[model samples]
Target: MLKTMHRPFHVSPWHLTLACGLFKLLLAAAAFALPLSQVDDLPRLVGLLLLAGGFSELLLSWTGRHSWVGRITFGSGALTVVLGALFIGGPWKGLYPLGPFVTVWFLLRALLSIDVAFQSRLTPMANWIWLLLRGFVDLALGLLLLAGAPLAMLAIVVFGEVREFVTLFSATLAVSFAIAGGGLVAIALTQRHYHRSDPFMIAS
Candidate 1:
């Protein structure tokens, strides 16, 4: 019987989720710690954050490749990666407007969070409610940026207080990322508990 028995090692998917969550938290901390003197580097920071998030999404898509969730995750990840590359590659001062770029970023992120929340409902994942709330928070932040971006740009142009605008933008991104990271960490911990109780339970 011992010769016939086999045990295969299986790494839990939540491990990746946990790592990604912790990474995002670190990113959030970095963003929050940015000083006013380094405001000029905000674009690069944003680009890096986008790249990190995009890669995480791409990896996550593998967990559900045959489902609609996977398709959306892949698409979102691709777009985010492209946008992040663009932001990092060029100065973008004369190429395009920052308002629209930021608006789209926030919107895409919001949609992804909302999609994840809905998908979580189909799984044994805990903290689906928190994911839903996080989605709404992302949505609200995106909408607020969409509505106020033009006004903010106008103010920047009139007053030439570019630093102030960058400051506010950085702060907003920091808070959003922090919330998202925290939510992920919480969900990952809960999923770990569930997994321990039942080895069959998996979180995607």
Candidate 2:
């Protein structure tokens, strides 16, 4: 006799994990496959990937339903959507614009992943180390973007003279996505519980 005005939505944690995993893999693939030869196309491709991440984050927001984490994710997802569009704009060409955005986006999600991975301390996940590793990697990338990248990278992003730098960035991006994505997929495949559920309201 579950009677309520609002229908409750039940969500599968594994499903969310799967969706996210697939998305991360796709992003990685796109990053690796992008036509780096054509510098003009890099911004657009990067924008598209960012948009994908935003969309995926939006979808994943449901997993956090009714929780602070969910609310934060929802907000960040919205911002990502806008930023993705901005990146796609022709004015924001080159790595300069995308670098900062990517850094922030990765850092935000990295912390989230680390926070959730802590659940393993109590729940004990066999592959929990991977999650921690992912977080550390993400943190490193963000820090690099903030300061680790050579100061001249800004000039390189603008002039496109240092093809090597761009190559390195793309490579790093691809690796990050691969590892993070794989972790998500593994988490989903192994998860055995439903995080939440939506039930139809029975009018009594």
Candidate 3:
């Protein structure tokens, strides 16, 4: 009975994957829920998404904190939470403040994704190639955002509207979130299936 109870307490990589997937889905929903026309809401939307992600990571880290990865995740979560709060409370307005901020965020996550995809090659993680592809997509999205920032500013100077720029960022985020969320969920399910079939085949 004690061993049976203890078994459930053991944390696995799939748990982290699932949590991240769910968080990303939440981001997608939030991004879609906010009308892109209300450009003022962009920063707030990003803040909420970051807060959700930070809390998810923090909770998962608490469960798996004996490992080095967990410690790193905890630190990241704390920093993310801080940043999220700042974004929410700050007096930022328009693309001038948000474009560069989100661009940097996407680029950092892209690098992390690519690194993790490579690391997973040593493990039996499912759809690792998809992960690699997602990383590339993220990288591309980040680059696009970076390039679009100046163009967006120019649009404001010429056309007096930044709707195209806003739409581009919003659409990119929604699509990226959906793709990453779906892939991570699939990978988690595959890992779960493999674990059931061979209890000792994969390490937690």
Winner by lDDT between candidate 2 and candidate 1: 2
**1-204 per-residue lDDT for model 3 (tens digits):** 112212121145676677788877878777665554477777777777778767876886676576544564576566567667867898987545766766776676677667656655544544667667777887899898887777788888897646666667677777777777777687778767666311221343
Ranked by lDDT, top first: 2, 3, 1
The order by descending TM-score is 1, 3, 2
Give all candidates' CA lDDT scores: 0.65, 0.67, 0.66
Q: Considering every candidate listed, which one attains the maximal TM-score? A: 1
Model 1 lDDT at residue 196 = 44
Looking at candidate 3, the ten consecutive residues that score lowest on lDDT are: 1-10
Query: How much does candidate 2 score in TM-score?
Result: 0.72
TM-score of predicted structure 1: 0.77
**Model 2 lDDT-worst window of ten:** 192-201
lDDT of 2 by residue, 80-100 (tens): 677678778758656665677
The sequence of per-residue lDDT tens digits that candidate 1 reaches over residues 1-204 is 113211111123666667767887887777666545455565676778778877876776666555555576578678778777876887665212565776787788788768767755645554667667767877777787778777777886786546656666666667777777777677678767767422222333
TM-score of each model, in listed order? 0.77, 0.72, 0.76
Clashing pairs in 2: 8-198, 8-199, 9-197, 9-198, 10-196, 10-197, 10-198, 11-196
Task: Report how far residue 197 has shifted in candidate 2, in Å.
Answer: 8.5
The lowest-lDDT stretch of 10 consecutive residues in candidate 1 is 1-10
